[model samples]
Target: MRTRLFALAAVAATALSGMSACTDSDDGDGGAASGGGTRAGAGAGKVGVILPDTTTSQRWGTDDPKLLQAAFDAADVPVDIQNAQGDKAQFQRIADSMIAGGVKVLMIVNLDSATGKVVLDKAKAEGVRTIDYDRLTLNGGADYYVSFDNEQVGVLQGQGLVRCMGGGATAGAEPPMIADLNGSPTDNNASQFKEGYDSVLQPRYDSGEYLKGPDQSVEDWDNKEAGVVFREMWEQTNKNIDGVLAANDGLGNAAISILKKDGMNGKIPVTGQDATVQGLQNILAGDQCMTVYKPIKKEADAAADLAIRLYRGERPTTGDRVKDPESGAYVPAVLLDPLPIAKKDINLVIKDGFVEKKAVCAGRFAPLCRDAGIK
Candidate 1:
């Protein structure tokens, strides 16, 4: 993984050579959080990256920054990556510091639009170009947006759930009652996830192929809150849920924990996204049906490439454009397709080098991974 990433960076450095002065407006005034802080790099120009929260998803603090930084480093572009840890105010402050430091490109995963708008507005005033990374900042006037085809992520989840539940269940059995544990309403990606999964599930529900059970939105994608809600919903439904449509890996794991207590872990199908280590492990253990794998390296590489172009004052070509749900303005976008990861396809991520063999094979999971032909 390290070797391949460095090779990518080396190539990028060649391409970006002597391109620093292409953009005159490199300095920006922007405003954020008690951040994970910044990682300063010495290069021709700097790209400032702000990840939303380490608490919500490990991708923000772990996977994304590593890949994003590697991409920037390969191209010899200096980068500063930081996290807000879910604090909107801290996110603003981090942006301010980046802007004051004369960052050429500002890429962010917004905590919320209200706070994001202020930061974007500030960056714009300082002549800094902005890229909405992972999450869109509706009407924030970001120059470009990059992320997975989030709705397709949901479609994959819904499809995976249908496979797990439909394949295992006895034909002609009573319509299965399913529950939804969605992500926070505040996130644009969360809404896209809901829409994606809902698009697949709602039709089944309407046709009586599946029955809708308890459905709830998890504020901030909080697992503890999801656990509480799932527990109560389970009790209220008399433990009637036959399938679970969890929005992401965290919520899926939360539901899995509760279901395990009731001895229903592998018996009910649960769907998730982010394809975190836990999510992959759960798929191996049969507790989770599948997870949406966005291939962080590709995502990070794309964002970094886009950031480099944006910093060089180049119009990055986009295959498509998407309307920000909030502002209804079509923004240039680079939306990558999401892949569905079930146990059989776990090898895909492994082969793609998304997860190191040792990371998933460590400890007691070694035997399970070996049993799954992962070793």
Candidate 2:
């Protein structure tokens, strides 16, 4: 599972200076609100944020709101952050509540483009500034966008698979059979991720260096559904699948579980994103190859920076812009780079405080963590 991808560790330079994971208390009304009492002036209304869901990734439930709250609290700007819990109706209701409550700025990690566009359009009609956080709303036409180089995240997965498969097809051996366990089709980031990994893998498939196996997308990035999907692919492939390009940690773990059931876990290389504790443990145990780490603190900071500026009624300028592939409109953006993590690079993530060392090295993983110099 070793590779030269350790060079990508430089992206950690923008990591959080100091912060540990903590439990965020609820605001009693089914959301988390931070900052002081309402301030008097033109742009003093609280900033409203709507997160996508908590089940798909831990970041939505634990990391994002806390980081965003800290950012707003530091600037003394009131904010209301809420998770939609993966419901489109709840997403709309949350947006309606924020807008009707006179929020000056609304930021969101949209559940989907159609749902987001409705909310963004409503906010725009009400003179509230909007920002697309992490996942861009396709035709939503958000004023600004903040996220990492998501396509690059997929590129890393493809490259990681190649490295774990012992490089390209050998002269006397058959080309490795690769399976793609993609993210939800409805997510724009999912499409971008597939585009990225395909850029790296399609070439090999064409050159006879690799054989493409079952390619499928998990519905809503559900872990249980992902397990079912991977199991089906395993049966369809007659367990001949050699490697997996799983879009994120959840999907990757799903495939790894299926492989483990057949005692083929370590034999088949698997790639993941999000660098969750489970994913890191899998890397430690040799069940998975690598995961992409997109520093959430950096993303939350960048989005909050933009929201703070908007809340102050100050025009924000960003050097980067991302065009909405569906609308052909360019959005002001603050894009960060994503880092690829292998077993050897797990220490970098721990050192960055994204995942606590204790959480990653718990119980059975303690020895493996030490062997990898994670102390």
Candidate 3:
């Protein structure tokens, strides 16, 4: 099951990357005026955005809203962005309210893929075009989906762990023992990430080059729950783990906290994603192997453009369709490439304007950030 999940993450990441790159050449500036459609006369309708949760990561509060807001403002479209706080019933109620409010475009980062389908169905019935943001609403049959190359996220995590383990075998020594702490079971991106990481790690495990430890899928990407789960795994396995393949930075941080309490901070190599401030701090401290950086600005801008197009009844330039697992139908999607950030390239994210120097270089991390050339 672990291997299968990893493979799926890889495929989804690759597909998303290809899609994101393909759309880069098209100039989508000037908001809704550039697109052709019936509702193109000024701002004809409102765009509704529903986010999954705020407690999971910093991106929800900082990056996601800012990027989406900038994009929508540039497109001259009115947007209403709401957070469900990880509540399924609340998410449903929010979507229902948006539909009743006569929203023309509905963009959502689904908390659960199954619940997302219900929201999408409701939107469709109400004649509202839906875009599955970040988390794909596969069975929901959304009009469009936008997100990073999720599988590549896994590949970077997997490759980083291998590199952190010293790249080559140590004189007839068996490969390092690693644990897999993945995201929620319902999140499609989690499966995609597992696929990418497993693509690189599974072969080693099968060949007896790397040892496998307790592999578990985290529920709802909860950091506290992840910490508890890792603690239990450590107790059960007697701390035999050498490396950890944590699906995202939140879980990685959770596992790292547990390892720290056990006096195993820098001893075990761990992988992460999102390139968040806390995650980057861990990387600088040499506690994390690496993180996959998906620029939120670009992703949010693209999603906003797509939403505006849909609102104006214009056909988007998306040419590919991803097959939904539940309905077995092709769903339109936009996939973006993800960058791998290591200690060496920590400055790159700063250079690319993904993160601000002040945001990452505060408090005790200032010296570390300066040493890392993070200006």
Q: Which portions of model 2 show Cα errors greater than 4 Å?
A: 1-41
Model 2 agreement with the true structure over 1-375: per-residue lDDT tens digits = 011211222232232221112222212211112232242124557999999999999899998989999999998889999999999999999999998898988999988889999998888777777889998899888888778878888888899999999976789988889999999988999998998999999999999999999999998899999999999999998989999999999999999999999999999999999999999999999999999999898888878876776676555455466778888867766677899999989989988889999999999999999998998
Please give the TM-score that candidate 2 achieves against the real structure.
0.89
lDDT of 3 at 253: 96
What is the model-wide C-alpha lDDT for candidate 2?
0.83
TM-score of each: 0.87, 0.89, 0.88
Per-candidate clash tally = 13, 0, 9
Assess the local accuracy of residue 104 in candidate 2 as a C-alpha lDDT between 0 and 100: 84
Pitting candidate 1 against candidate 2, the one with the higher lDDT is 2
Which candidate ranks first by TM-score, i.e. highest?
2
After superposition on all CA atoms, how large is the RMSD of candidate 1?
Answer: 7.0
- Candidate 1 residues lying further than 4 Å off, grouped into runs, are 1-45, 167-173
- Higher-ranked by lDDT: 2 or 3: 2
Please write out the lDDT profile of model 1 over residues 293-322, one tens digit for every residue. Answer: 887776787779878766555544454467
Which residue pairs show backbone clashes in model 2? none
Better of 1 and 3 by TM-score: 3
Candidate number of the best lDDT: 2
* Model 3: lowest-lDDT 10 consecutive positions: 1-10
The order by descending TM-score is: 2, 3, 1
